[model samples]
Target: MNIEKARFNMIEQQIRPWNVLDKDILDMLIVVKRENYFPQDQKTLAFFDTELPLPDGSKAMSPKLEARIVQELGLKKQESVLLIGAASGYLAALLAHMSSHVTVLETSLALKELAEKNLAADGVRNVSVLLADGLSGQHTGSYDVIVIAGAVEAVPETLKKQLNVGGRLLAIVGRLPVMQAELITRSADAAYDTRSVFDTVVAAAPGAVPSSQFKF
Candidate 1:
């Protein structure tokens, strides 16, 4: 199959109808080359809007899901961002284009290294790949934006705390049919506000912190 035609179909048929209308993001998708992030065996299926398998049995979030979250984060050109579950650094690369600085945290050593290599090859200097359990929060400074590549049963408390007063986070919450893609923001009032962006499911990060039984 022709890769360009497939990409155009993905952007037009799958992503665009999902409310990913920003021309810049659409253009970035075209330039970033998703196939480069996929395992060679699966490269031909890169733009199929389906999760691609990883060595650890985990999976990359689908193109549509990625588009939805990227669209929801609404990154700015002069903002520092934190990314959880940096698989192959594709999302981080996308964020690097729109944000000033990005810190990508990944639990898997192999994935972290893979991300670093890909980001460097792409000249995405604004992103740093860190080995850490991103679910619990690893940084101290205020971040203007955060994007979690994997779905979680609940948003970690510290991740919420890490956001600056006006920072925003895009993550998927819940399980199965109840799974919802959400955008959480630390409002100026020092309160968190959340809104569902769409319905989707993605593999939970390998070492994601599980919420307490009481957390909803």
Candidate 2:
């Protein structure tokens, strides 16, 4: 396959048409070499407009989705990020380039190792991969940005509370047929503002269970 041509097509045909217009983000898509984050068997799917399946039964966000989420967050270089669901660590690597630092939480140990290996191999120094339950919201230090890397039935308040004042969070919320990408901002006085950005669907984030599993 002509790697550079495929990447250009992915940016022009897939990412750009999806409304990911940020030049920095578009450039990062080129710089990051998405294929490097995929396992050997899945490398061919790297530039395709689809989610790559991970070993833990979770899916990585499509390239367009990843770009859109980063563009929507309007990340600044000085901010810190906490990313939930470190599927292969690709998203965290993307986040790292846009922010000062990134801390990624993953429930699967193998995936945590894979993410670390991929990021380290790519020389992504600003990201830290940790084996932790993102749904538990423990050990997730406050940050200026938080990304729930997959779909969820709902955005838990515990995760919302971890946001620093003026921080922003991006999450894909709802059920399988369709889900809305929502951006939440932390305002003063412990308040939050949320607005739906777009609609799409992907696999539920690792560790996210049906709402019925919780007791009242």
Report the number of the highest-TM-score candidate.
2
For model 1, the run of ten residues with the poorest summed lDDT = 205-214
Per-residue error at 30 for model 2, in Å?
Answer: 1.0
By summed lDDT, which 10 consecutive residues of candidate 2 come out lowest? 133-142
Estimate the overall C-alpha local distance difference test score of candidate 2: 0.89
lDDT of each: 0.82, 0.89
Off by over 4 Å in 1: 209-216
TM-score for each candidate, following the candidate numbering: 0.92, 0.96
lDDT of 1 by residue, 36-135 (tens): 7776788788888788876556788888877777778888899999888878778888888888999988888888888888888777889988888887
Q: Alpha-carbon error at 60 in model 2, in Å?
A: 1.7
